[model samples]
Structures are given as structure tokens and as C-alpha cells.
Target: MPKIIRDLEKKIFNTSMELFLENGYEGVDMKMIAKKCSIAVGTLYNYYPNKKELYIAILNESWNDTFKRFDKLKTLQLTPREKVEKAILMLYEDIEKRRGLGKELLNKNIKDLIEDARVSEFKKALIKNMEMSISCLEKKEAYKDDNSINIRLAEILLVSIPILIESHRHEKEENIRFLNEMLDGFIL
Candidate 1:
């Protein structure tokens, strides 16, 4: 895509996410998105045929943005344990920053949008990034063994940390501390 087009798509996606978070999926419409984006409704449709498509584009952009940040972190010469800790912390912080829209974007029903080719490709990229991160942990002997169980467990922990943070967000500081300690025991 051209630079200008990509920029416009990103602006539209951000605006759509904010509107969706504020008004919910059913409450927001294409016109609202266009108005918020300061773009013509026709221009928005040129990029996304429908609201579901726009929403999936937003999800893909979010995931792509995350991997870009992680890519930069991957360049650091940190140990595997530090990598895992930092990755978890960074991901948690990002999710916390967009907690409301993140919750909506993660709804299981959104998987239906994966039927789109671009969305499916983005999902595959996410899985690949996750597996690479898991492999890094395995290299550090973080897992007890190379068995499928250990690998699966590592993947589970990688995905679960964010959920744990979300669930504990409203709890006391002590509870958050205890959860992190428990996670360190399992992850390290």
C-alpha cells in the first residue's frame, strides 16, 4: 500500500477502536468511523467493506504493532529469563493501556473474522512470534524438558500472563505481588 493509504487506514483503525470501546461494537457504525477519521465514507469503504472487516483490520494492526515492538526488544542481548520477564511486562503494559478495546478485540467471536485472508495471515504471524519466544525460553533451560508437555506449558504461560494481569487488575497490590511471584516460579 502507498504510505498515505496506510496512514489513513491506521488512523481509521484507531478511531474505530476508540469508538467501539466507548459505544460498543453494536453501537458504532461506519459513518461514525468515517466522521471520526475525517475521511469520506466511500474512502473508508475502499479500505474496509464493512464494520467487521474494519474491526479485523484494527485487530491485525494492533498485533502487528505489538510484534514491531517485540522485534526491537529481540535485538537486545538479554538472557532468556530476562527476555521472558520483560516480554510479559511489556505485553501486560500494552494491554493495560488499551484494556477496554483489548477485551473486545479478544472476544472468541472475533475469530469469525479470521476468514479474511489478511486477518488469517496476521494470526499466523502472531503464532509464529509466540513460538519463537517459547523457543527462546526452551534454549535457556527454563522448561524441565523438551517434551511436548513442557513446550505446551511454556506457550500456555506465555499467553496466560496477560490474562492473569487483567484478572488481577482490580485486586490489591499485595495480590498482584503474590501473582507475579507465583508466575516467576512457574515461568522461570
Candidate 2:
């Protein structure tokens, strides 16, 4: 029989996230994580295999949490545009809460691993959610159905918001106002 460590994976994930957030990818290693978790290095490897894998796992979990929040918003009585606007704010809040981990994760050294990790699935999901919001608007009076336009809006928001966050962290209100204006042309 194999030895079991209760909540080992959760502990590992939490510890790894804390260390990575505090020290960055280069500053944290499997050994450090293992030591913090009071596990042998090999045991940690049994769970995560490598640092990149562990980092990707953390990225996936964080995005999943964000998506969960998105789902909760669906039950509200807000309009489609309101949903998208609120979701955009949630995305900004999520990135801001990460405390520079987003920038560190985008470092060139780890960009390849991010692709390999299928992190784009989160982007696709966000776009799909946005598309759903746009499609819902078509059912409302005076809104037209334009599949191509809806998709483009979704893709543009998916691509641009993070860039805005990274580039203009200090001017969030200005960025949101500009985005809302742009989105108004398409979404409203």
C-alpha cells in the first residue's frame, strides 16, 4: 500500500502560492516548498513533478476561482451589458489581488510553459462567457443579432483588459471609463 498524506496536495498548493507570490518563480523552488510543507523533496515531486507544473496548477486554480465568481453573477437581474461590465471589474480585481504575480507569470521564461499548460482554456472560457452575455442581449428589444460582432467584442475584451491592467495599473478608473465607452458602442 502507498503512504497517504491527508490534504497534502492542498497544503502544497497553498504553500507554493504563498511562496511564489512572495518570492516569485525564480525565487521559489520545489525544495523550499517541500521544506515549508514539511515533506521530503521527492514527496513534493510525487504531487507536482516540477516547478512549472506546480505554477501552472496554481494559475488554473486561480482562474477557476474567478470563473466561479462569474457564475454567481449569472443569477443576478442585471442586463447582459451589466454582466459583462461587472465581470470585467471582477477580472481587474482578481489581477490586482494577485499582487504582481500576474506580471511575474508573464515573464518570458515561463511564457512557453503557460501555453503548454493550456491556460488559454481560461481565456476561451472568458470569451465564451462574454459571448453568452452578448447573445442574451439579442433577445432584448431593439438589439440585433450579429454573431461576428459579438465574437469580436468578446475577443477584444478578453485580449485588451489584461493589457490595460498591466499597462495602466494606476489609471484603473480611466481605463474602465474608456472600456465602458468602447463597449457601449458594441454592447449597448
Give TM-scores for every candidate, taking all chains together and pairing residue i with residue i.
0.66, 0.70
Residues 1-188, candidate 1, lDDT per residue (tens digit)? 53255588778877898897788666789999998887789888998899987776666666667889789878889987566556656666665666554454345575545356776576456556555555565332554565554345445544565576667777534443553464455454
**How close is each model in CA RMSD to the real structure?**
5.4, 4.7
Best-performing candidate as measured by TM-score: 2
Q: List the residue pairs that clash in candidate 1.
A: none
Cα lDDT of model 2 overall?
Answer: 0.75
Tens digits of per-residue lDDT, candidate 2, 1-188, equal: 65677999999999999998899888898999999999889999988879988987897787788778878988899987788778778767787677555454445676655566365565567678776666665432334654477777767766677688778989998887777677766544
lDDT of each: 0.64, 0.75
